[model samples]
Target: MKYGVYLRPKPERAISGDAYTIREAEGSVLLGLADGLGSGEEAARASRLAVACIEEHASLPLVEILQRCHFALRNTRGVVLGLLRVDLQAGQVRYAGVGNIGIYALTREPFHPISYNGIVGYRLPRVHEFVAPYHPGDLFVLYSDGVNGAFHGNEALLRTEEDPQEIAGTIARLYGRPDDDVSVLVAR
Candidate 1:
């Protein structure tokens, strides 16, 4: 798998309220992105906690991992999280998300996966996991709301970019909002 990640804080802040994790485990590649409730230090803390929870429970089902994050972040500002598991051996990708995080798949039959509403630690709705076939050259992008959703319109860039890192950087640079923390993760 090839993947890249980019993160940036709000213009005036020294810390970002978004965090992401990518790990290869048990024949699957785990990808996660979390955005804390608000900006600044407390927000950053919540997002970090969410990512840590995902890492600790990397072996669990996607819904269960988010549940664990809910429990782990109850005392903090809470967060919005998105999780994706690419099972290379199984040739499928499974995803679960809460709140505004975005997940886009670039493949022969591309589609947008749905994310449920609510905050992770504060008010989680029933979690729904989506599974889709994974092809060898398929690419997936997950981004925080801080990046404009319209960036997805640039299918040419997403398809033509050779390096995942450059795709991530280009998306953030062009669509990131200065008023909010931004994060983008690209995987192929």
Candidate 2:
């Protein structure tokens, strides 16, 4: 899978509390995003820790990875997390998420994965797993709640074979606000 990510802090802050990572793991690709409880260094630490833990345990099941993140983050301010694993060859996508992070399959008929209500580290119920079809040209997009909920990029952009970075940047530019940190990630 080809993917790109973009993140920015609130206008008044020098750093953002949101963190994300995309990497190949075993036979699938792993995409993880975390948004700390607030905007600041502590929040950044929480998000960084969540993403780091996810990266380290990329081989584990989605539930196990979420469990590890919860345990690892017990000492800090909690974060909302979304994790996705895509096996292109197998035409499958496995996902698990908590809180408001958004995950969508940007095909002709878009698919939005519903994240359960909970915070990753502090308060969470039994995490649920979701599955979706994985197609070569289809785009999968994820973002923090900071991004404007109403901002969906031009359909033509998705139709073209544009670079993932371009798509992410475009979304961030159009929907990102000055009042909060924002992050946009796109995978194709």
Give per-residue lDDT, candidate 1, residue 109: 59
Sequence-dependent TM-score of model 1: 0.97
Report how far residue 82 has shifted in candidate 1, in Å.
0.2
Candidate 1: Cα lDDT at 72:
98
| TM-score for each predicted model, relative to the true structure | 0.97, 0.93
Encode model 1's per-residue lDDT on 1-188: one tens digit a residue: 99989999989999999999998977899999999988899999999999999999999999999999999999998999999999999998999999999888887655568889999999999998998888888999999999997877898888885899999999999998888999999998
**What is the lDDT of every predicted structure here?**
0.91, 0.86
Error of 2 at 10 (Å): 1.1
lDDT of 2 by residue, 69-131 (tens): 999999999999999888877978888999999877775444567778888889886987887
